[model samples]
Target: MAAAEVSHKDLETGPPTGSEKHTNGVGSKVKAHRTKDAQHGDKDLLQNVFIGAIDAGTTSSRFLILDGAGTPVAQHQIELDQSYPRPGWHEHDPQQLIDSVRECMEKATADFTSKGHDVSDIRAIGITNQRETTLVWDTETGEPLHPAIAWPDTRTQALVRELKEREGADELRELCGLPLSTYPSAVKLVWLLRNVDAVREAYEAGRLSFGTVDTWLLYHLNGGLEEKSNVTDATNASRTMFMNLHTLEYDDKLLDFFNLDRNKLRLPKIVPSSSPDAFGKVSEGSLRGVRITGCLGDQSAAMVGQKAFTPGSAKNTYGTGCFLLYNVGEEPVISKHGLLATVAYHFGRDKKPVYALEGSIAVAGSGVKFLMNNLGFVEQSHEITDLAATVEDNGGCVFVTAFSGLFAPYWIDDAKGTIFGITQHTTQGHIARATLEATCFQTKAILDAMAKDSGQPLAELAVDGGMSASDLCMQTQADIINIPVVRPAMRETTSLGAAFAAGFAVGIWKEFHELESINQKGRTVFEPDISEKKSAKMFKKWSKAVEMCRGWSDEDEDDASDQE
Candidate 1:
């Protein structure tokens, strides 16, 4: 049978009724870009099926289509607009996020067909998203009660402190594999229930729906309230502070600790990262009717994309935030250190959940964004390296990027961003160099802690995400860590991970080793070029900066003390 031709205009679709509308930015219709110039083949294209992945990230929404061999056939991305209403608070228009996903999927699928591939060959769709970003909406009206609370938002710090004071509050670490911090969804949800009038009313009326980005996209992609496609993968659910790490289900004690009335809010069902039926089918757009068979948090997806399935293997993703995951096999290790114990992946109910110790850095690529938008140092993010290249090094400068406080190893909540060793010789280049070096320094710190936590020194660190594109940054990472830094030819591992999960469900890829050859044609390895003494000296300077940055938030504490 011949494949049907799809018009670009036919890709535009409407949102759920009563949902907020979005203004089209690029074009009125979904656009297409051919991945290859090959002619159509006469064989049954269904046998040569492709898989799709939706990477709903903090900064952008991306859609990727991959063939059986894990080669990308089509790709499209649209940057998302995030609003910071106040310092340390971030938000996104939930409806706009859903709209962006639909647009990217439509455009990328159109591109797949333009390359002479069959869109019908897209067997299933997978989702990988920014974890811990919380959202709530009206179940009946399909309308968000408040803006989506971003993962980096720190509005609930006071609440976290109050919870910390409560007896047995620390017990939650063992239960949920997370500390009582503002980063978890449980605290964010509590803040919303108690503060937001709309959320409060919805809670009282029992109409509120809560989820991370994965659940939000899954809910709407499965036709919102109509299809009741409210589900989240185990990987995404693990960050919620509600799920029991042992059972992979919401625990009653966890709920009671947060004082959440489960009857008032609807929690999405926890399913495997890759499932045959749970995620449901895409209701509308160019790739309409495609089943969403897999879902994962962005970091877990990157680990899978890098094929870091074996124990002791690790990878770090440098996105809006930086996340390093050290795979710890099937058993969850409750972190004694300030790291997080999280589910790496869950193949299915029959298989045990893979676990990892995670170190999260709040500012990474956003440090570059600050230089671009806030300081006017550059117009584009990639231009940051050029500015940094002007300087020999950080010029004896150190930047401790604690925009939302620090995470992992040093859980310093009282610290803010600080720049040290500024003099008459300071320039934008020095600051840019310091900014990029801050990330590398933090990566070294996390790896140090990972080595202690796992009892295994990292052989090499596999890297991905936007900032990993900078060779200067990678070399600096290698130099500071004194370990080789590795990156793939294609840095879109987050999206590829989702595609791998979806493809696995449909039998496109049989085993983990089968994906070993995907995108292996060209791999870049940055070996450590600096002596250990020099690396230690550089890291010591960074450590001094971090130490000095602490207690900067004490003024706020003093103001609160005065009120008392």
Candidate 2:
């Protein structure tokens, strides 16, 4: 944990002075953006400069202030409520998200402001968020008509079922590179219209507008209460099932499929994921006047955070769930595997887009949440890592954390979470190790599918997110995949990724080479030390456990299936 606590200030790229150069992956030419208390006499060496980034995630929202090169100087974070109104229902107060954003910004900027940091030093803010969570509200008043429906909510299962029965169901996946799951916004929109009275009336009156969390926050953050500034990045727009992947605009077929009127519904202007005119300036609060310069779906930002821009570079984020993305460059490849084609980022309306092939696991960190809260295996999330480290191995146990069904590669939505290979000899340590192993197994499967679809064999995987802090889990990941697991010196990669996008877009920084030079900060590379034979043996056992977990409890399947 001490090793993980080190910051990556040493690796940040230099400010954009024109030449796009990088050395060993860190930016050079130290320049002060945010004041670092001039305690450094001539003898003290200068390092990174400061920038701001905000990351909106599923479980919480955080604000980070990074220096010129890409290391977090100070951060503020808050966890919001997760509402489960009923079985398979998940929601967040849209207003809560808005309030949380304001609060977090205040906290992160408090230190800078207190020290009398120059406002000019803070160039812009980059925004990254949980993709596909739906937000809809009145256009004029900026009031959410209903709670924001989260991506994990399966209340839209019936809606997804109906869509599948529609004529174009089969082609939706090929067209959108996404299956007709309850996760996307299209079905959620349908459910909201049917079930929520306010949504129905708003839609009928043509006063309703919808967007992902990024759009919602940006709308409010950019003076929505006073003026209209609502817009969404292309990456967020693509997940809505309404946008044409190639055209980067709303499609007629999708509108017809979801029974949505483009004009009636407020759609954010599609902007480049990185751009100057694309994002709005925060109108109020401590971050007031700070240009909102960058936006991307959280997963894409995670890939960027890992600096996986190079082809054949891959990353998997261990969060409430897990997502693996392989950077496929400018073109979006329609996935042959059960994965999705996504825009990594469009440098904000001007720069050509970066694309990725993504596969997700619906239940990664949430599985630990279950053991800690539901099953009482541990006291807190951090303790899970320590408990797992207690065991030399899983002791012939395996767990398929399918609490909410499997995602990516498998797409086994009907399956529930399961523990496999449990015997009388099994101990708590085995279960703890199995839980961690579960994350790695699902990650490997997703990466394999990603590789198959994108035609890129990853040489290494750069990982981040909450769970990536676990050394044991990272080592397991490296050993299982037979590739080096590179953990960045800075763990707050999400916020840094957002800052990078915003800074680059505004010319605070220029090319990837320039960003690369800011700093390489040190990295912990976990190599595959296990023999191939041993690796194969564990995988075989893990595979069998996965099969056993499938088709467990037909009654529950029937119940969940009947709801659809």
Estimated TM-score per prediction? 0.90, 0.88
Query: Tens-digit lDDT track for model 1 on 1-564?
Result: 000001111111221122122222211111111122223232244337788988888877778887766667788888788898767788999988999989998899889999888878789998889889999999888899899989888877777778899887969899889887768888888888877888888988999999999899988898887887788988988999999999999999999988888898899999899888888899988788888888889899999998999999999888777899999999999887688999999988467789999998888888888888899998877777777877677778899989888987788877889999999999999999899888899999999988888888999999887787666777679888888787676777887899888877777666787766665645566667668999999999899889999888753542221110
Model 2 segments beyond 4 Å from truth? 1-49, 348-350, 551-564
**lDDT tens per residue, model 2, 264-285:** 7877888888887667798987
The prediction achieving the highest TM-score against the true structure is: 1
Query: Each candidate's lDDT (Cα)?
Result: 0.80, 0.73
Residue 126 error, candidate 2, Å: 1.2
Q: How close is candidate 1 to the true structure, as a TM-score?
A: 0.90
Model 2: residue 426 alpha-carbon error in angstroms:
2.3
Superposing all C-alpha atoms, what RMSD in Å does each candidate have to the true structure? 9.9, 8.0
Q: After superposition, how far is residue 347 of candidate 2 from its true place, in Å?
A: 0.7
Alpha-carbon deviation at 191 in model 2, angstroms: 1.3
